[model samples]
Target: MYRPPHFAVDDLPTQQALIRAHPLGLLVVAGPGGLTADPIPFLLDAGEGPFGRLRCHVARANPVWRTIGAGAEVLVVFQAAEGYVTPGWYETKRETGKVVPTWNYALVQVHGRARAIEDTDWIATQIADLTALQEAARPEPWAVDDAPAPFIAAQMRGIVGIEIPIARIEGKWKVSQNRPEADRSGVAEGFAAQGAAGAAMAGLVRDFGRERG
Candidate 1:
């Protein structure tokens, strides 16, 4: 992630929150053939290492498990995105004419070492815990044990669990932090005016301004 100083976001708490809130991530790993990426829904198990660990599962037939071996480094990319930033929002666009169109969003890059959950008991626990966490967020939460024993066992057997001990995290928040206050305010108001995702991004721009104050 190449980030300029004005666009850099080094806040750890913010990064973790971004990753957690955006449960779906792109897990990328290298293998003999080439690089592979999987869009997976993961659980952030927050009690393992200092930065905790990431938990996810892949279909047993998916070759990704074999490539992501013990101690193999992996990159998990989470996108906490909003909307596009229009050039007309910037005051400089009409004044000095020094601004161009850019995107406004947040993202996190977590680097970790992976270990395959091979133990049957541990794998079962992982499946249960993951299902519980995901269901907890729904309107009518579904329990993992709701399924029949034979069906659940069969389903579990078809998947492989993964545990990623996070080694490092890098965050980038590009919500017009590089702009001056006047331009920032102009952008915020512009976003709020559009009544799209831009409206939420405006709040992020405003928050960053408040923090710098």
Candidate 2:
């Protein structure tokens, strides 16, 4: 992550918030077979370590869990809102025509050592917790016990659990913080006009800009 001072977010709580909001992370690992990347939904235990602990799972057939040895370093990238910002959004575009297009986004990168767990109890608890987290917002929440016991057991047998105790974490929030106040406000307004797709970035721009002031 190339984090300029203005775009850097070093606060632990802020980074954890982004991860919780966007639980799906890109898991990257390097091993004897080379590098592999997979999109996986994660559960974060913020109090587990200095940074945090990440829990996820992979299909048993997937080589990722098998290729990486115990304590191998891995990266999990959690990306929140992101959008393209046109130069037209900057007030400077009108003043001096010097503004260029850029991207505005909020993301967190977690570096940790992974541990593969085959314990059925651990995997069962992991799946239950993950399910609760995702289903809590639903009108009728589902649970592991909602299905037949044998069916659920068979399904669980096909996956392996992965745990990572975070060694370091980095957060980047490039939401026009590098721009001047007027330019940042212009960008926010431009994004606001875009409706739902732009709402998150617009809020980020406003929040980060206020922090700058």
Candidate 3:
């Protein structure tokens, strides 16, 4: 991640929050054939290691697990929020007509050595935890135990578990922090007028933009 100082997200708590909110990660690794990327939802176990650990699963038939061995280095990319930033939103565009279009988004990249887990007990526990995390907000939350044990066990057989003890994390939050205060405000206002998609970007600007000096 090539992040400029103004757009970097170095706070540990902030990065962790982003991961929890956006649990799906693009898991990428080098394989015998080439690079393989799998979109997988992860569970962040903050207490597992110094940095943390990521737990996810892939289908047993997915060739990625076959070529990428246990303990191989991998990257999991978590994308938080993203939206297009129109040049027209910048005050500079009106003042000097110098601004061009750019994108505003938040993302985190976690680097670690991944290990495949074959233990049925561990995989079951992970699936249950992951299910709880995602279903917690529902009025009637569903659980892995909702189904029959034999059925759950049979379903689990079709997948393989993977874990990564995080080595490093890089986060980038490009939410118009580099722009001047007036320009930043302009962008937020512009987004507010554009509806829900743009309003999401506006919310990020309001939250993180205040932190900028």
Candidate 4:
């Protein structure tokens, strides 16, 4: 998280928004066994604390849970709307030929003390809420209760829940904000032409670029 002044995003709401939009986070931990990382989908409860609380789960068979001691410090990284920006997209490339390629991205890094929970009720509620969040837009949404009770119980038995109360959060939005107005506009136009894959980034570039200008 090397955040330059231009790329730093300190707003709490903005950081939480990215987490909600990109719920899958890279969970990192350093324990007695050493450092380990895993990709896990998370739920953010923004009102829970000064920063917020994060909830997620992993398979019981996964060794990650075992490594996390009570209140162990951990980091979860959430990334949204990112892409490669070619130097060709910068107007400066034509003017002075000084621009180089770079990656444009928006991300949040949350540092927290993690606790592993084995309570069945907590895990059940966590999975249900997570499922609803992801399935709300689907025409035919599925629920944890949709399956047989025994089957659901059996499946739940194989997983463990994780909860983290956020201690610190940092957001970085490198969306052409460091570029000049003309160069930023060039980036917006180039990314806009890329359709859905670039839509989010294009909007970010335009909005942040305008703010800077």
Candidate 5:
């Protein structure tokens, strides 16, 4: 992730929060066939390592886990939020007509050595944790125990676990931080008025500005 200083998010807590909120990540690996990317929902255990540990499962039928050795290096990419930013949204556009369109977004990248887990017990626990995390906010939360044990066990057999002990972590928050305060404010208000596509990004921009203060 090529990030400029203004857009860099070096805070560990913030990065972890972003990962937890946006759990689905693109897991990429290299193999004899070539580079492969798999989108999988992950569980981030920040207390497990200096940076953290990431856990996810891939379908047993997917050849990725088989070809990419357990010791292989992998990168998990998580996209938090992103939206198109029109130049007209910047106050500078009217002042100098020098501004161009860009994008406002937040993302995190985790790099680590991945290992495959075939142990049924480990997979079972992972399934439970993942299920609980995702269902926590639902009005009617679901749990792995809600299903028949035999059925759950059978389903688990079709997937394999991939664990990454985080060696490196990077976060980038490009939310108009490079622009002047007036311009930044304009962007936030502009995004807010743009409806769903920009509403989330608008909130992020405002929150980021508050942090800077």
Candidate 6:
């Protein structure tokens, strides 16, 4: 998370919001082999810890479960992203010189201590909890019990649940914040002129300046 000063996201509440909105994330950890990363949907488990925790699961046979990795550090990157800033978007292009293209996006990185929750009951509980979190927006949602007991038990046996206690959070939002005001405005205009999500995100980045910072 080597963030330049201008593009850094230092606000705690904003970081939490980004994590919540983008609940699905990339979970990365250095393991017995090297570094392993899994694209996972997680529940941001917020409670007593000042920084909260991350909870997710994967298939037990996935090989990420074989190690005894309690207390090992992990990183979860939740991305609230928009992309592909074209060379045509910079205000500087009109002003002085031609600039190479660049990208614009937003993301939050949470560093944490991780452990495999080995107890079946604990794993089941976490599954139930995570399922609820995913189903929160549904009016009539499915439950874990939708499957046959034997089938679910078999499925559960194939998966492993993980818990990560977040220790440090580093969030970076590089949505033209590093640019001058005219350049930022130019990017936003360029995005809007194209009628894309990038423009919408540019607006968000602008509004975010007034809020998060």
The candidate maximizing TM-score is: 2
lDDT of each: 0.83, 0.92, 0.88, 0.92, 0.90, 0.78
C-alpha RMSD for every candidate: 2.0, 1.3, 1.4, 1.4, 1.7, 2.5
Steric clashes per prediction: 0, 0, 0, 0, 0, 1
Better candidate number, 2 or 6, judged by lDDT: 2
**CA lDDT, candidate 6, residue 82:** 76
lDDT at position 64, candidate 4: 82
TM-score of each: 0.91, 0.97, 0.95, 0.96, 0.95, 0.87
Task: Give lDDT tens digits, candidate 1, residues 98-181.
Answer: 888887888888898887776678778888887787788799888878889899888888888888988988888888887887
- Judged by TM-score relative to the true structure, which candidate is superior, 2 or 4? 2
Q: Which ten residues in a row have the lowest lDDT in candidate 6?
A: 204-213
Lowest summed lDDT across 10 adjacent residues in model 3 is found at 204-213
Model 3 gets an lDDT of 0.88
Number of the predicted model whose lDDT against the real structure is largest: 4
Per-residue CA lDDT of candidate 2, range 109-158, in tens? Answer: 99988988899999999999999999999999999999999999999999
Residue-level lDDT of model 6, residues 1-213, one tens digit each, is 789877787788888888888889998877889998889888876663987788888887777655536777788889886777776777798887767788777899988778887678977888888787778789987788887989888878888888888899888887777666777777777777766655667676576433223
Model 4, residue 160: C-alpha shift (Å)? 0.6
RMSD of candidate 1 to the true fold? 2.0
| Collision pairs in model 6 | 60-158
Give RMSD (Å) of candidate 4 vs. truth. Answer: 1.4
Ranking of all predicted structures according to lDDT, beginning with the best and ending with the worst = 4, 2, 5, 3, 1, 6
Q: The CA-based lDDT of model 5 is what?
A: 0.90
lDDT of 4 by residue, 50-74 (tens): 9999999999998888788568889
Consecutive 10-residue window with the lowest summed lDDT within model 4: 204-213
- Compared with the true structure, what per-residue lDDT tens digits does model 5 show for residues 1-213? 898777889899999999999999999999898899999999999999799899999999998888756699999999987988899888888999998899889999999999999999999999999999889999999999999989998999999999999999999999987788888899899888989877889999988853332
